[model samples]
Target: GCFWHHHDCYLFKVPATRTAFWLDKIAKNVARDRRDIGRLAEQGWRVLVVWECALRGRKKLNDDELGERLEEWICGGGPCAQIDTQGIGVLDVTSPPYRM
Candidate 1:
């Protein structure tokens, strides 16, 4: 389901089995994601991507911090952004007020 006010929140996952198939599928999914984001942005919607790494493992952020950061982004009026692990670096999609 869609989030409040057209915000699309997706939990991306890639299966370990079928390496070649998964890679191809994931690549297609990434392309679709970019296309969808661009179309949505054209309609004035905001996107916030929360990577799996940001919610688990040794480099994860605490629940409270995550919540705060999400709230800040949603209310802070950022056009597009992503929250990921330090090691994952960041993705710059370039949609104004965008960040990693």
Candidate 2:
């Protein structure tokens, strides 16, 4: 199943020597969510978190449309530039691959 997240929202395809985190009970699993995000960022992955608030107010939105839009955003398509028909700023991302 496809998620509403863009491929580059985090370190999706990097040589990450790490895993993600959860809100609770991580470590027996991984680590705290904020920690994981910060680690990935420190390791040079451009991360973008889509909080619950961003998912709300989309009554007429179709899931597929959002997924496609996300893909475009992660592909360096420019987000903070254009305003959508709904007058909301698109949050596009661009992360340079980390060098060893």
Candidate 2 stretches with Cα past 4 Å from truth are 1-31, 50-60, 77-100
Clashes of each: 0, 1
lDDT of 2 by residue, 1-100 (tens): 0012212222223233433432122222222443555566668665544433224444323566556655655776432322222222433333311110
lDDT (CA) for every model shown?
0.57, 0.35
Tell me, what's the RMSD of every candidate? Answer: 7.5, 12.6
lDDT of 1 at 75: 71
Encode model 1's per-residue lDDT on 13-91: one tens digit a residue. Answer: 4446787786675555566667788788889987777766578767677887787777777677467677765422233
lDDT, residue 78, candidate 1: 66
